[model samples]
Target: MSATPPPYHQTAVRPDWRDLPDGLREAVGGRLGASVVAARTATAGFTGGFAAVLTTATGARVFVKAADLARQRHLADWYARELAVLARLPADLPVPRPHWALDAAGWYAVGLDAVDGRTPRLPWDPAELDAVLAGYAGVAAALADPPAGLTALGLPRLADLARSDILWWEEVAAGREPVPPLIPPARDRLPELVALESRLPGYAAAAPGLAHGDLRVDNVLLDPAGRAWFCDWNWLCHGPAWFDLAGLLITGYADGAGLDAVFAAHPAAVDAPPDALDVTLAALAGYYLTAAGPPATADPASGAGTVGPGAGPAGGNPAGTSALLGAHRRFSGEQALRWLAARQGWH
Candidate 1:
């Protein structure tokens, strides 16, 4: 097995609620009432945008997350989409409940019910996986049919997403980028690999329901009782239920957890073709790699390393890079490539 890459840190830089423009803060305060006196920033996300918990003088609290479209044009769209999705999600889903939206002072912000929870422990605790999987089942059932409001949101389908993120082998083969050291096998077989990747766009299954387009470990939180609540509604979409299931399973995969065991227990896998899993994993890899910088320029051990800017004051925008963020991207991409490699035998 290849050595483990660095774990993804919750390095998202969020402004303290008070740091926001006075007008915006006043608007939020007026909406929630001026009783709010304490605000603390959370370093758990990678958005690097505006996110923090606001506590009222009376002890009421709300998790406020926002973005400055001027600096984060992409995040603005995501924030808008999140407001749309959260407003219409089924009542039974475990997402944080939205209280209000604030589009003021050159910002897009939303106040939500602050979840009292922690991220799932790494190394795939079986119990936690069980709870999250069960939550997926409920979500699948509640969303068996797309909500009337979502059908018009124009969310991308699975194949649509894959098309947006073509394989890295294609990039390297075309001289657009160099291959990373993590997947040396691809360098010599670019043609074969690229040809095989052509099948991805057509493998998208019919929309099973709503899909959490960006489901990953960091986006999920575990409550005190062990139930799971998925955060980050910015990437919600209408697609096969199994897409998010595959993502959650992939998180476990990176930790050396047995994906087969977990997949066997999910109803989403029922009657699903084996190739379905392959397609999801491939698309995920594509997404991660696309956000990363050029592949490793030298041996990682020699300290010729790259990093993602992470979610610093620059915000956790994908366009930024820090040594740590880069490793996380590479690590995630490597896991994805490994998962895909296991599915197909090379020529």
Candidate 2:
């Protein structure tokens, strides 16, 4: 990452307390054991899901997320999966605890103990980044030998998922997809990119364990005590610990931190392959760059032209998701690529 990095903030179009249906509101109140007095909608993340910190008449505050079961079944399923994952996490970890969940009035909602915290400020606060890294160190240590209960969930492996979903350089090299505009310098280097990303599956398989598959700054919360609490568990998977460390360091790299020293000093980097960081960056760059490509115009399912940003493709825009997701991906991809280029002197 350079002295300047792409913006990490996201402005979501979320529903307010008043927008919730009567039945849904009552259901949430019942779960909280009191009537609601005030609500503060969260401004982070790239989703349209109902996410807020609600204050009850009894002065109790809790975080709640709801999705319309009928209109956003996929989002509802994600919420359900996250609830289950949160329930199984170690009690002492900084991750939130899931208290309860309910289905009411065609909507599914879950409640969690709210933390008096805010997302980490960008430009990489040294103390805040230290807190996030320290917190993630503990998470990685615990997941290195994941509890049997979490393993019982039979979560997908990152190797398999990456091979299927993240390896887009191969597609670009074979002419199946267009080269992303952000990487015109990468046109002649697709083969090298492919080779770099190709090593990820093997490296991941060699030291397989639990990983916070989506370990980004937005997914972390810094408490008043300066502890980092990880959030958004729907993408949990089995992978190498260094994978999360690398992802976390992307922002650090963009913040102009001495990442080589920072990465080597981290506990998660122990026993990691010498080239692990490059592999992870290559895979991430390919994933984000390809995902951030121009929106599809044809509905692959119907073979007809479609409208909107995420219209027609295998991973096209789905309901209840954020529209700014593409912008986020583009920014992330550019950061990863720039960082990788700097490290490898590809510039």
Q: List model 1 lDDT by residue over 63-155, tens digit each.
A: 987778687666767777787888888888899988988788898788888988877766677788788888778877777688888667877
Candidate number with greatest lDDT: 2
Question: What is the C-alpha lDDT profile of model 2 across 244-308, one tens digit per residue?
Answer: 88887774443567777778889999989999988998888888777765643443223222112
Q: Candidate 2 overall Cα lDDT vs. reference?
A: 0.78
Total clashes in model 1, counting residue pairs 3 or more apart in sequence or in different chains: 10
TM-scores, all models, native as reference: 0.84, 0.91
Off by over 4 Å in 1: 1-9, 166-168, 184-196, 252-256, 294-323, 343-347
Off by over 4 Å in 2: 1-10, 183-185, 251-253, 295-314
Question: In candidate 2, which residue pairs get closer than 3 Å at backbone N, Cα or C atoms, i.e. clash?
Answer: 1-253, 1-254
Among residues 3 or more apart in sequence or in different chains, the pairs in candidate 1 whose N, CA or C atoms overlap within 3 Å are 47-316, 48-315, 48-316, 307-322, 307-323, 308-321, 308-322, 308-326, 309-321, 309-322
Q: Model 2 — TM-score against the truth?
A: 0.91
